[model samples]
Every structure is written in C-alpha cells, then in structure tokens.
Target: EDQVTQSPEALRLQEGESSSLNCSYTVSGLRGLFWYRQDPGKGPEFLFTLYSAGEEKEKERLKATLTKKESFLHITAPKPEDSATYLCAVQAYSNNDMRFGAGTRLTVKP
Candidate 1:
C-alpha cells in the first residue's frame, strides 16, 4: 500500500528562524514528487517538482529535495509571511495518481 506522511504536524518559529519539514512516502513505480504551500482558505501554490532521487528545487527561502522514499522542505531564515500549510504529493507511474500528505502547518511569528 502506498502512503504519505509528514512529521511535526505543526511547527512554530520566530521570524528569521530556520527549519526543515519532512515528508515520508511509499509508492509503487514513482513518477514524481510535488511540493506546495497553501495559505488558509486558499488553494495550494506549487513550489517544486522532483522527478527522481537526488532531485532538488528552490524558491526564495524554500528548498525541496527528494530521495527514493522521502522528501524534505528546508526553510532558511523564514519571515512571518512564510507561515502556511506545506503539502507533499506523490504521483505513481502505473496509475498516474497522486497521494498527498496530511501537511505540515508552519507558523512564523514576529
């Protein structure tokens, strides 16, 4: 059975603090891994698309990396505006279906 799980369901950080969030997943015939950020009541904004192990992508203060069975989103010196729910989704090749993690809620306070 394929599944996705994110650790530290919630995180609180002071402005300018740095941290990393984890997304663990298991899938048959992996196709890609996606990272997204969603603000309250809003649709998720795409952050990255990782196609294979050792792939990585970055935008502003966020960096996403992927391996065979897991992915990580690293935030460097985040600001209050960075607060949001981070989501990870995986697509499998066989069915072209995507499974999403519960998400990690991050709060950056000043």
Candidate 2:
C-alpha cells in the first residue's frame, strides 16, 4: 500500500523557534512528492515538489527535502503567521489519485 505519515500531529512553537517535521512514506515507484501548507478552513497551498533523493526546495521560513523513503519539512524562525497544517502527498506513476498524510499542525505563538 502507498501511504504517507507525518509525525508530531500538533506542534506548539514559540515565535522564532525552529523545528523540523518528519514525513514517512511507503510507496511504489514514486512519481513525485508534494508539500503543502494549509490554514484553518482553507485548502492546501502548494509549497514544493521533490522528484528524487537529495532534492530540496525552500521559500521564506520553510524548506522541504525528499528521499527515496521519506521527506522532511523544516521551519526556521517561524512567526505566528506561519502557524498552519503541513501536508504531504505522494503521486504514484500508476494512478492519478494523490494520497496525503493526515498533516502536522504547527502553532507558532507570538
């Protein structure tokens, strides 16, 4: 079965606190890995697309990297505005459906 799991279902971070969230995945012939950020009551916003091991992408205070078996989302000096749920999804070559992780909810306190 192709699946994705994210650790620390919820994270409370003081403003400026840095952390890394883990995403473990089990899939067949990974076509792509995607990272998204979602605020409460809204659909996820695309962040990054990682195609292979050792590939990384970054924007603002967030960075994402992918490997053959897993992916990581790192946050640096995050602010309250950064608080949101981080979601990961995997695309399999054999299907058009995208499977997603439950998500890691991050709360950045001011």
Task: Note the Cα lDDT for every prediction shown.
Answer: 0.94, 0.94
Where does candidate 2 have its weakest 10-residue lDDT segment? 61-70
RMSD of 1: 0.7
Pick the TM-score winner. Answer: 2
Q: What is the lDDT of candidate 1?
A: 0.94
Off by over 4 Å in 2: none
Superposing every Cα of model 2 onto the true structure, what RMSD results?
A: 0.6
| 1-110 per-residue lDDT for model 2 (tens digits) | 99999998999999999999999999898999999999989999999999999999999999999888899999999999999999999999989988999999999999
Q: After superposition, how far is residue 89 of candidate 1 from its true place, in Å?
A: 0.4
2-83, model 1: which lDDT tens digit per residue? 7999988999999998999999999998889999999999999998999999988999999999999899999999999999
